[model samples]
Target: MSHPHLHQPRCLAGIVIYRPEFEALRGLVVSLSGDVATVAIYANSPISGEQQQALRKAASPAKLVILRPGLNRGLGAAYNALHQLAQADGNAFLLLLDQDSAPRPGMAGALMATYRRLAERGERPAAIGPQPVDLAGEKMQLPAAARQNGEKPLRASFVISSGSLIHLDAMAAIGGFRTDYFIDAIDIEWCLRAGAAGYSIWVDPTVPMPHRLGQGVIRLPLGLLLTDQPPRRLYTYVRNQLAMLRLQHVPVRHKAKFLLSLPVRLAVHLVHHRFSADCTVALVNGLRDGVLVRLGPPDRALIPFWRQGWRSRATTPRNTAAVPAALRQS
Candidate 1:
């Protein structure tokens, strides 16, 4: 299964960094340098000059460009910026990577080969991604419809943002990632939109990338595995899923499934957090803002309350409704 274009530098790799582990980021950059034309590091968190120099050194031979926005602009914004960079640089494809993902050396090549095969058969593929394997060596499960039948790429409903190789033209036609989504569900929303736009999403099951979803997995009875996400992440997870349900382009079946599981998900979070007041407030406010279509950054008033070690007796407003209408509007 040799791809003649395996070493071709037609792709631009974009890695989004947010308080990432230094060695992990450096390793990722090194792994991708030889395969892609250029490696672009989008710093969602501030990076010191010393770290920048070290990263540039790690990305040797391949050009490295660091995009420092000087603020946390969310995953979608970073991807959108990377997409623009890909277009401007005239690269054929864009490879999106999160800081935590550890892609195998030839992952990008495998994805591109699959994309080519699909195109040869007249299938319009918007993007192709590698199958993700968690640290425990367990492969992420795909829906039955998405399973690979033969040599063809798996027809996934959506693939995670990390390890995904997106065709520049297809991305242009579908429009870039949604900045409003901020951090969560950015990939799912984009894939759904791509499907609606008559383009297919594929997964190269033969290619596996090491990726972790949240803090870790919480194994409960009956073999249920819930990702252990922080309260802030929990807020966006609930909020974005609810927001997606309102979009017409999002599939009806997906929305139905989410609605059925929403309550259970909330219950699990409550128990996981040990009924912490911060978790309760985040969940409640997520629901309220999601229903009200307050789609932007997280509500300002709730920020301090959800952070680590904030006293519950501090008496902060629990929901956006409690914030002044003027402040909420802001």
Candidate 2:
């Protein structure tokens, strides 16, 4: 695996993983880059031969290179690792993707257009992402926001890492991702810092990036139907959200609503998932930690095995006492 030097442009759109759905993934890359002249940052598995052959066929016009990490680092680490690789290639735009996600029609182009337009207008709105729609091409229920004018940049309450685009300049200004976060709310925390620093964040509603809502491995066939809520997700959701609530700038109402809504969401998760031991554990963990930490990142060890950086962090007084010993060790 060749590691390119870091001081280059970020024109590459990277797919982060060890295991891959190269056919599905390379298909998206081919569609977006129009050339496989792209790179795969593999923390564990190399791109497979079948996937490779498919990539070769579909990835023509696009360029593809695979970089094998010395070990299986987590998603944030993979991205920080990929960040340099993308810049090394002299590409101007860096797109973040999960193995299962892809950009819809205008997503790639429109987001690029928005970024350029924002920059030309002299805006430094920290980070931006596509308005995510759920699978089956439906829009997720998103909070409504009135369009704001001017350069303070719009403050974003929530941002997803997958399909997220960050300005390299912003990274330079704020320093690279807070790697110490290692697990949850990474994107939200970073955006919060930028918002705090007066950088605006806006979602280009025109870009329709689709996300696979967490219904789980068993119910994936539901294709938006409910089954088991991913246990690990529940864990991170609880712990890290609490951490964010601690941040002073977060809207008081948002925090209060979230706190109040916890039980209802958990009940829904429990009913849908049958409150299996994992779900129950996750429910307990989520509420306990969300309150104490405000739903930010988890102890580095508890990170569920997964992919992508467009995801952890928070501002809270240390509560080494509040963390569950098991999660702390994981």
Top model number, lDDT: 1
Candidate 1: tens digits of C-alpha lDDT, residues 1-330: 533334563888999988899999999998887677778988877777898888888887667888877667677778877887787887899999998899977677778888888999999999898888888877876554344555557888898899999999998788878776677888998999999999999888778888998988888788767788887778888878887877888999999998998888899889989989778878876776566555667753255434533322312211112111121100
What TM-score would candidate 1 get against the native? Answer: 0.87
**How displaced is residue 109 in candidate 1, in Å?**
1.3
What would the per-residue lDDT of candidate 2 be over residues 89-196, giving only the tens digit for each residue?
A: 656666777765777533545565677778798877656787677677765433332244343323455567778776666655654554434455667666666766
The regions of model 1 sitting more than 4 angstroms off are 1-9, 144-151, 220-222, 301-330
lDDT of 1: 0.78
Clashes of 2: 35
